[model samples]
Target chain A: MATQDKSSIFADIDEGEVDQEDENVDRWRRNLRLWRETLAKQWRMLTDDLMVRLAMITIAFFMIVAVFAPFIAPRGPLTRQYEGDAGIIIADWVEPSFLSSESEYLLGTTAEGFDIFSQLVYGSRAALLVGLVAAVFTAGIGTLVGLTAGYYGGKIDDTLMRIVDFLYGMPLLPTVIILVALMGPSLWNILFAIIVLQWRSTARVIRSQALSLRERPFVKAAQVAGASDWHIISRHLAPNVLPLSFLYGAFAIAWAILAEAGVSFIGLGDPNTVSWGTMLQSSRAYSALDFGAWWWFIPPGICIGLVVISGFLIGRGYEEITNPELR
Target chain B: MSDTGAPDVSDENPLLRVEGLQKHFQINEGLISSLLRATMGKEADYVHAVDGVSFELERGETLGLAGESGCGKTTTGMSLVKLHEPTDGRIEFRGMDLTESDDEELDEFRQNAQMIFQDPFESLNPRMTVYDTLAEPLRIHDIENETARIRRALEFAELQPPDHYFDQYPHELSGGQRQRVAIARALVLDPDFIVADEPVSMLDVSLRAGVLSLMERMTEEFNLSVVYISHDLSLLRHMCDRLAIMYMGEIVEKGATEDIIENPQHPYTRSLINAVPVPDPDVGRERVELAGEVGDAIDVPSGCRFHGRCSEYIGDICETDSPSLEQKAEFDDDREVSCHLYDSCGKQS
Candidate 1:
């Protein structure tokens, strides 16, 4: 009997190991199938609406442009030169040939004879980076804090909400000024300022949504299933909260972009890097409106308008996907 | 009454023994001054949610715990599964003290004791397909050979043609089908005990009996000891082998089903039994209209919890000393009643 028991124990151990291997395989297979199904569903979503497809394509086009601007633009963005004949020029302004110069740049010349097209192309990179990165940082922090506050509603919730309220009361423009002054003006610093101020709204929205989701019976069922607190948050709570987060994140991206433009248009952004906002700043400083230099200012202004509009359209597309009720 | 002191004929061994269970929620003073009182030494009072409730369930027996809303019936059921930790007392399952178990042991105990929630519509994960929902417990408990286990569970729950339903999302299924899937999920782990918390209450009246029968069949087939909780007393009388009646967080009466229904001793029990709607059109029974609303469970009555609504209150004695459960002389061994009338009168002559 003792020998038989030992043999059975060994057999059980072997079976346990086999079972573990089988489960791993099964989980991988299941996850693969689930991914395929999700892809199929998203494909259906993409094909169903013209607006969503258009929005996606437009965003994609801008991203490609932003990535390959260095290769695409003809002249170096910062290099300046005196156009027409320098010898014939008076008071260091343009020469007689400037008005009728057939050998002009693609987007014409700026006040300093820099290529406007090159500046616009290169500025897209900074604007897009700051907007996307800032939105991601703010959304990630907001989601974590909101999920914690909403899932475990006690002193933690109260303290976090109080902090949100306190932050909400601060004047936006003045706060940005203070932050920029303290941290010094750079692309990364501007992104940081926008995220620090903007995360409160996302946190508030996420907390409200989470407050409703936490009371859901599935959450309690997950608790009774012997799931730990972390498992409950990640598995049960996070999936439901993600759609809302994505919706808010799209809007946050647009907001961050606008805020970055506002700061840089007022001369707080990096003076060296020619962002669209900085281009606008230089155009306004030189009074391109009074001088009628459409090539210098109009193109950069149009670029800013197109970027913000694309961000808004993308936000609307995401809103429709996350909330079918809205559709 | 049997000589072995076992209420049910199936087995003499008790699978679960709950003694003096209590759950009190401390209600903060008020909205305005609670913030101020937090800093001061003043303490918040409590709502006595599940005060001094006790019962025992033998192996393979269905014990129905019936009471109105806010009477702590659900709280009692949750306490057994350790969903809400009991404030005081002991719950012994399979001779192991549940309150004393560590986190690991408690987890093992949770695997042994499962729960079926009330709302079939909201209880399930709308995002998950029926297969994943059913397979979740098996995965969590580390059951071997997933395909076979899932097939067997689906078959056991009578989800016929498993292939047709396995890939279907929860929203596509009917309420009854969703509930069947929920039951399949609960049973997949092969648990020894299950807490059915108003499992059939949310279903249509026509569908209620079918769900109840399925539960009954599963209880016998799996040899599971169940604590079936509901507010419907007639259903309890039909489904359970033993019955425990709770009033304002206290079990006022408990006995075999026949004894509690046919010969209820406590006034609260009598009121509950009388409230059960009779099916026969000609049989006109006097509905015992309970006076006033149920008193605050937070501030329970001074003496007996049910004294505010009890019809047979015996003056100051009923108001002064709280009554403890005593065995009725007529059905001495089987039935217990908590009333001052029984305390002084000793036995009904």
Candidate 2:
């Protein structure tokens, strides 16, 4: 009887091992197939939408312009130089006689002898950098705070939300003005200001999302699975809020760009840098309206408009991808 | 009895033991009103969710905890697993005091003690496919070669032909399939114990029996100790080795399943048993209609917690001094009751 019992136990153990091996092989195959399915779905979405394709092209153009500004611009953006017999590059482009009797700059030039086209192209680098970086900074901070506060409600949530409310209620324009005054006007400083002001709204949205998500059974499952607070926030909670983050990030970039331009137009921008807002400020300083030099302001204004429009399109595309119910 | 019967492990050898567990939620009235009420000395009111509950489970045994809604059955389960911080209690799992364990220790304890939630539909993450969901616990517990373990666990839960299910999302699967995935996820870590919180209650009646039988099989195959919580006493009796009946956050009666079902001493237990729908059409068992709704746990009755609703109340003593759970005189070995009627009945004899 003892020998038979031992033999049966060994047989059971052997059977379990066989079952386990078979299961492992099956699981690997299933994971591969699911991943392929998800990838296929995303690929279909990418190819199907015209608006999404347009937004992608515009983003690609902006990125290329930003990356290859030196090669694309006619002259160094910051250098003040003149062609022979021309007052400066700007005069050469705008005044027909400055470069040659028969020559005309296609896009004209500023009164300071700088090429308007070149400045418009090069200015994109700074605007794109500030917009992308500042939006990322704002979104990252907001997502973390929102995720933490939302996932772990009670005192932490109350305190963080109160801070968000206080910030949201503050006069945003005046706060930016004061921030510029304290930090001094520079690209990085302006970026900092935009992020500080912008993070609150994202935090509020994320917090509300987190509040709803924290009570979800998946979150409870994560908790029971011995997941740490950080693990639960990152693995289960963060992914759900990511689509919202992407949408908010794009919108925030557009807002930041507009705000930067507004501050520069109001004479709060760096005196050394040549941003679209600074171009407007310089044009205003030269009394371009009085002199009728349309070359100075129109190109920069158009660039700003185009960038903001592109940002909105990208944001809309992200909204479509994130919200399947809407789709 | 002498202290040598089971080596007196009641004080030392319990695998999981809970004592005097309570959870109270403070009601926050509107701001101005609450402030005024605070000054008037009626500052706060509480919902005594789990009020002074206690129970024990030995290693390798399934303890079925059953009670009606709002009776703190789920709360008791949650407290044992530390899902909610107990208002007051000592929970010992494998002789380690859970209440005093620090965060690191609690984390370690959690890896050993997992919970399977009720709702199969909502419990799993919608974003993750079956593979990632199963892989999550294994990754969290640092289980090695997770792919192999996940497959093994899935098979253990009887989700056979594991390849077909490996890629399927919860939405794609049927209700039974999703529950199997839930159980597989819980079992991935090779946990020593599990808290199944009404695991099969939400499934169809036909599907419920399958899930219940699967759990029993897993319990034996894995040699796992479990706390099977539910409102279905009949299912509990079928699946559990021991049974504890909770009423308003306290266990009114507890014993081996056979003993408790055959001869329930507490009025509350008898009522619950009567309420269990008789499956046979011909056997018309009299349904004991309980008096009043279940009492408020926050401000429970004066003496006995069940006195207000108990049908077999033994006079004013039932209203003034709460009866303590003691071994019944008739059953020398395995049964306990906390009711004045039992005590008075004994005295009369």
Best by TM-score: 1
Clashing pairs in 2: A90-A113, A90-A114
List, residue by residue over A37-149, the lDDT tens digit for candidate 2. Answer: 87688657754678767766777797898889888887765565456464442432264334445535545566676666677777887788878997798889999999989
In model 2, how large is the Cα lDDT of residue B160? 86
- Candidate 1 per-residue lDDT, tens place, B1-349, comes to 1123222322334778898999888785556788777778676778888998888887678999988898999889989998888999889875568889877667667676888999988888876777777667666666566555566667667788776787787789988888888888787766778999999888888887778888888887777889989988888888899999988898888889888998888898888889888889999887787888878886678988788888988798778888887675555556778887764336421
Interface RMSD of each: 10.5, 9.3
What is the alpha-carbon lDDT for the whole of candidate 2?
0.79
Q: Scored by CA lDDT, what does every candidate get?
A: 0.77, 0.79
TM-score: model 1, chain A: 0.86
List the RMSD of every prediction in angstroms. Answer: 5.4, 5.4
TM-score, structure 2 vs. true: 0.86
Stretches of candidate 1 off by over 4 Å are A1-25, A39-43, A46-49, A83-103, B1-13, B28-32, B38-42, B343-349
lDDT of 1 by residue, A144-260 (tens): 889889888888989999999998999766787679878998888888888888889889988887888877777777666777777777767777777677767777767777777
Expressed as tens digits, the lDDT of each residue in B252-334 for candidate 2 is 88889988887787899999998888778999876778989989866777889889888877799989998877675666647
The TM-score between candidate 1 and the true structure equals 0.89
